[model samples]
Target: MARSGNVWSRAGVALFQLAEYLHEPGASVGYTLANWNISFGGSVAMGAHRSSLREPSMVAAGVLAVDIIDGNGNIRHIQRDESSDEWLADSCPSGITTCTV
Candidate 1:
């Protein structure tokens, strides 16, 4: 995680905690950003049995959508591979939707 010097720094910490909680065995998470009015949901799947003496692993999947915000905030929607600068400045229009990995 990146660190920022501001009062909203707590937001980053909270987000990290939320991620950790979702990674717990049999755990899941769903959240909405009230300020941005966008919703997100995802779950973690445990890969190894608990009784085995091997390190456990997890996989996660989720999607995020733009609510009323314009393509500016839509950077959140870009796939993990897409470049934010290219998409925000060149690809999508004002109010359309785009999905990222």
Candidate 2:
């Protein structure tokens, strides 16, 4: 009985940490806002009820990186020139790995 409570307590703490990290703008490519226009967000919910057996829950985590665009067109792994604004990125919100509202 005590062991079960410990497990859920850890899960709850992890959920809170993840929520805080998501609030940040995005992962820093250069540790600055030059190319820090990435999007990373999701919803997390947890509820507890009286039960003898523990129910499994699904948790998913993934990266939301920018799709690069060189002078020609959309491509993978195109280096961005932070000094000049010529480099481009896809309109991030619409472009996601497998994002959902």
On lDDT, the leading prediction is 1
Candidate lDDT values, in order = 0.29, 0.27
Tell me, by TM-score, which candidate is best. 1
Q: What overall lDDT, based on C-alpha atoms, would model 2 receive against the true structure?
A: 0.27
Q: Candidate 1 at residue 51, lDDT?
A: 24
Q: How many residue pairs collide in each prediction?
A: 3, 0
**For candidate 1, what is the lDDT?**
0.29
Candidate 1: minimum summed lDDT over ten consecutive residues — where?
39-48
State TM-scores per candidate. Answer: 0.20, 0.18
lDDT of each residue in 27-55, candidate 2, tens digit only = 21111111122222222111111122332
What would the per-residue lDDT of candidate 1 be over residues 17-59, giving only the tens digit for each residue?
Answer: 5545555543433342222221111121111112222322221
- Taking all chains together, the TM-score of candidate 1 against the true structure is 0.20
